[model samples]
Target: MSSKAYRVALSASGAALGAIAAYWALLAARQGHILFDTRKLPVVALSGDFSTYSHTVPGGMVRGYVYHPHGEAALQDLFVYFAGRGEDVRATAKALHWLPEGFGFAAVNYRGMADSEGHPSEIASVADAVQLANHLRKAFPHARLHVVGRSLGSGVAIQLVAQQKFSSLQLITPYDSMLEVAKKRFPLVPLSLLLRHQFNSLAHCIGVAAKTQVLLAERDDVVLPERSAKLIAAWPTPVSVRTIAGSDHHSIIGFEETWLLLVDFALTAVLAMPEAV
Candidate 1:
């Protein structure tokens, strides 16, 4: 009825709208897909003898698919992979041809992903990846275990490496930390502090004593390509790296040649397998 009353009503509406915006932002961060723009490859038909194994994690049963061809002695080195957020590990495993119709490769689901249980925290995924890798290593005692993490998953691998030494480390288009990355993307607001998932890959990567390798893409859209290069430069030891010629962040992993380069790195630089076997 009065001009003062009308002003008050407008103020209340603005406050409500701002609250809605804040809530949506919080939901986005919790989803943990800040840079996860790609779809995981389809599940490939297993061309090997290994079977899928499921184990009880704290929250729920986490399943891992093992692909090892029959009678092929497990190479001292095994590749353990952590797929990016919203992506499944099965396809990435098959896409890399890690199973190769004869060798063993293990792909794990961190909590909150398919078949895995519980909410995903940045540290929890890192811990989960390590736990699953160890389980696979013990199951196949002959194999040497290594880790590969892609994008956000790279942070997971880095954390695991900080606690335990892998045969080698491989990171694909990883960020320095989830907090820093969010800050950069949402400079207008304080997203980093609001973000609950703080995967600090840069800090953890430094602690790894194992031979480390990084894959960078020239056109990475998710993470700055320069940052990836910087990470390599910052490593105390000489971390081997290869940049995909024309690939971007999401497409790099699925490329045919990318797999070739990865296989080469894992087998030669990291694994040190004797060619005779």
Candidate 2:
């Protein structure tokens, strides 16, 4: 080949490689932003008595609320929630009123989300969960603790359940891992190389001992149904699975059946627990 032609080809190849490298870097950097919703959620006027709670993490505070049913002197159980990305946990805490008397609900904003400080990542969020769980356990040592997680938060919940002891766990529209979910959406993006937050619930499933229930949205396009199945398949114990008809990823929680299912499963878990010595 002529020297001039060879030089031109070499320069073009270098440019192409550089562009690809830049593209990969951009994807890697965006993984954090994509996995976490750090924006402020719309303020909804909450009803009932909700106590504000906060936990000090490495960088900043994790702010949240705990709501107990009115007229209830003794709490029977507590529901600790890990909300989906961008979900307003205040609204979720309000909905806890659906639980019968003696039931309490608690939830915290992930770091870098809402009023919570620091950045959101798999490791940091999981660590925050551990702190929150310890706090909740210490505060209400007598009450049975149950966990509820939605979408992105499901990963955090799964990891927490793996390390902590919970009476029950409910996961709504969860995935095996963020890496798998991203690959399903962007098949050509090379998420294995570019994605930073791999919330690999499947890997943690072996450690979970809680009575688990998994709810799936029939039309969930965001978290492909198969991804959830992979986590369910990995569970050390049997997991009860249900599909809410006529719902997608975001809409599944809106159904009355969903809440009923969650509450029923929680109660069932409590009933099945051996009486405390």
TM-score of each model, in listed order: 0.82, 0.89
**Residue 251 C-alpha lDDT in model 1:** 79
Sequence-dependent TM-score of model 2: 0.89
Error of 2 at 135 (Å): 1.0
TM-score top scorer? 2
**Per-residue lDDT of model 1, residues 1-277, tens digit only:** 6999999999999999899788767756554533443333444555555578776767687777776655537445567787876777665655645344334567866665655665567766766676787777677776667788888888888878778866777888877777766666677665554667767666776787877888888787668865676667677788887888889887778877776666677677543644321
Per-residue C-alpha lDDT of model 2 across residues 10-119, encoded as one tens digit per residue: 99999999998897787777666567867777776766677778977768788888777563347777788898988778866645656777778888888878778877
Q: Model 1: residues >4 Å from true position, as ranges? A: 1-13, 20-25, 28-48, 71-75, 98-102, 270-277
Candidate 1 has a TM-score of 0.82
Residue 145 lDDT (model 1):
72
